[model samples]
Target: MSTHVVVGVDGSVPATEAVEWAAADARRRGLDLRLVHVGPQWLHEGDAGHCARALEEAAGRARAVADGVKVTTEVLSGNVVEELIRESAAADALVLGSRGLGGFAGMMVGSVSLAVAGHAAGPVVVVRTAGAAGAAGASGHGTVVVGHDGSDDSRAAMEYAVEQARARHARLHVVSAWQLPVFSPYAVAYSGLVEDVVREEQAAARERVTPWRQANPDLVITDEQPCAHPVSALMDAAATADLVVVGSRGRGGFASAVLGSVGHGVLHHVTCPVAVVRPRQEDRA
Candidate 1:
């Protein structure tokens, strides 16, 4: 079956860019592209016609970029995030503009992108606009980075990242980070404590990637140790990578609810596109 990539659009410039990117990707991979637009019920009643026209225009732009790729568009009336989550479940992958019409300035990503990354059943990519400063990286193909922490969610993310790397024929960079607990000064002050801690964590990370590397010898693996912030380290690496993949939640944060801080932080700060993957609830539990 042809891979189906679903891109969420809200008639914004970023959304248009995402459509173009998705179109090019779909064409290159011999896949199908689905463009989805969701808005409030009032917008649907007041501006549904305009929304339809916008989708047509976006579709035209996508076709112009990569002709012959099967493109489909849909405008749904409901909560934007919920609709996107539902549609994404049926697709092999989901793509969205990093920020949309409604979002706070401090926020690196729009709420819709955050919601999808946090909850989508499959892999979700947040595409940044080209006009943004310091955003462009290695052309269509470059290094793909996946953040792993030995959790099931991170394992799932690694699986998706490996598949994407293979599909794009790009190098894969797997990252895992460890930091001393800030709340415990005693641990930091102890002699050789930090070194010992880092060594153990790095060892664990290497162990985690061992099987994956054995299975795919071609994958380029880079293990890193970012001070105390996983988010900052991931964002720094993502700036140079073609794609950054991370799990929606990790071991340290709120496990039963929304996305953790690192995932949320990367969503906002990374210059390159990011993919957030979540495993099934049973798997997570």
Candidate 2:
């Protein structure tokens, strides 16, 4: 694994928030913090200087917030999303603002942020703006939420979430949302069958985390298996969480697809910082 945390900088308020979040994470993980600003291809002389100042300012803010972390600055000129994805290949995690300067008004998630999160090699964290996040994004709640569905991808996300919760000395909330199969509208007297399915799903969800709970006896872990949509369950959990984590793709996702629908949906709606983690390259095989 890389020994540094990389965050994209664009001198926007949301970017500043992302820098603060990444800096604190770098401090916690004892990794170097790299502040990267990607300039457009048609960069003029004046624009180059402005990019430099933005990097410098971002670096200073990183140092102010995370004193011990080693911070570095880089200004790259290329396609913003492509360059950041390349950076993520060699970093522990890539952090970005929920939206950047190029973002349209009233847009919650920028195209760049979503594109990088979908294609990045490692974990990608999109930090929402304070005003946009509202109360859910406010003071730390000492709780980290993760979505799980007994899939390999979810297991990877769970591992990452466990490490984060342990580092923060916070509780881990494992949420598994399951839906019952739809029966024919004309069918009748299936109450017992519906009840049986619910019980089985609840049990399976609970069983999947039993080992994690037992293994980390000292770490407080809670499991929530709700009969609802995955996004809804996760959003409810993230309402008072410090962070919410989800795998890049889940079980039923297409093998060629990098980001799953649930992961993408949460990124657009979740009020807290969202981490989209993909299984390691080696593990995917």
Candidate 3:
């Protein structure tokens, strides 16, 4: 099957940057690109002819970046996140701007992007404002870092990271962090043992993906063992990565929720783009 990338755009600068980045990626990987613009239901009426026109212009911009890449335009009327999720259900991946033009003081990430990243069925890529233009000029050479903790969700993230690395011809950085019990009565006495246990956990994480790395010799694998919180370590590593891949949820608390603390923390802290991967409900059961 051909790869399909869905990009959410609303005529803002960040959305335009996301469209450009998604277009370049689709062109390089020989994938189809879908540009989606969602507005309030009231705008769908005669009040927002300009919104439809802007979507056409965005479509033209996407087409100019890549020739014959099956570029399609869509304008939906509903909640922004709901419309995006509905449209991107069958897509191979979803690319969205970190922030949009809605709400007061667009300093923080937009709610639409965060909602989709947390709950999308397939891989969701959140593109930030920085390196937006640079990403278009050059194919990404930096590595794709995926956070794995031996969970099914993390394995799904790894699968997406491997595919992205193959497409971009970049290295894959597999990272896992471990922390000792904070409230243990003998914490001081077992400090050394805790350190050793953390190291062993990191080693096991490395072993989990060894077979996949061996199969793809071209993939350079790097493992990290940070003596800090999982969210902080992953965010620090993501600063220099081309893309940060993470599971929707990890092994700790809130395992039943769609997004866990570590995933949510990275979404707000990381500067680079983040891809959250999750398996389908049927696969999980």
Candidate 4:
């Protein structure tokens, strides 16, 4: 495991907010903080001073959040996604703003943040502006949500979620959302069968978390298997969450999507800070 947290900094409001969140998390995890500024090769040719200033200012913001934390800054010249992905390989977690200016700029959650979340190793946290909750950062809501669908990735997500809950002394909610498979128009006769399958799925979902609950007897762990879309179920749970976590991929509704359909949707919709945890290389298979 790495000993520090790396945050992409571009001096945008969202990026600044991300620095704050990353710094706080670094302190909580007893890790150092590193501020990174990445830009295209062409931009770097003429923006040397600007890059330094951006990194310096971001480092200051990070220091303000945790004065005792050691902070460092670096300027990289290359494709934003590629450099950040490389950075993620050696960091405990890679943090980025949901949207940014300059190199990190885009609409809504932004393409860069989503792309990195999909490919980065370890955990990639996308911290959005305070739009949904009128404030950003982990606001001590005392709840953390994670989406699990019995896949390896989901299992990894649960591990990360459990650690986060323990760190914050928050509740952990594992959500498994399911839906009936598409049937032919004349398949109404299979209604009873559909109900049976739904019940089975719900039971399996609950069973998946049973071991976790038993092992962490002191921690408040809860599991919900709802007959609904994964994104909707997670969003509903996130409405009162301080942080929401999801894996890079999963089964069923999530499929093996780059970031998993559910994870991508949650990042765009969840009000709380979101963490996308990718399983280690050995566990990817």
Worst ten-residue run, lDDT, model 3?
A: 102-111
The 10-residue segment with the lowest total lDDT in model 4: 130-139
RMSD of 2: 3.2
TM-score of each: 0.84, 0.91, 0.87, 0.91
| Candidate 3 residue 93 C-alpha distance from true site, Å | 1.0
Residue pairs in collision within model 4: none
- In model 1, the runs with Cα more than 4 Å from the true position are 42-46, 102-110, 131-141, 182-189, 252-260, 281-285
CA lDDT of 169 in candidate 4?
77
Off by over 4 Å in 3: 44-47, 102-110, 139-141, 183-188, 252-260
CA RMSD of all predictions: 3.9, 3.2, 3.0, 2.4
After superposing all C-alphas onto the true structure, candidate 3 shows an RMSD in angstroms of 3.0
> What's the CA error at residue 78 for candidate 2, in Å?
0.8
Question: lDDT: which is higher, 3 or 4?
Answer: 4
Q: How do the residues 1-285 of candidate 4 rate in per-residue lDDT, one tens digit apiece?
A: 689999998878888888888888888778999999987777644577778888899988888778899999998888889999999999989988888777665624648878888888888888875542312233567888998887888888888888878877789998888887887889889899888998898888888899999989878998889888888988999988878888888886556434536777888888678989888786676
List, residue by residue over 201-235, the lDDT tens digit for candidate 2: 88888998999998888889999898877887888
Taken over the whole model, the C-alpha lDDT of each candidate is 0.72, 0.80, 0.73, 0.82
In terms of lDDT, model 1 sits at 0.72
Residue clash pairs of candidate 2: none
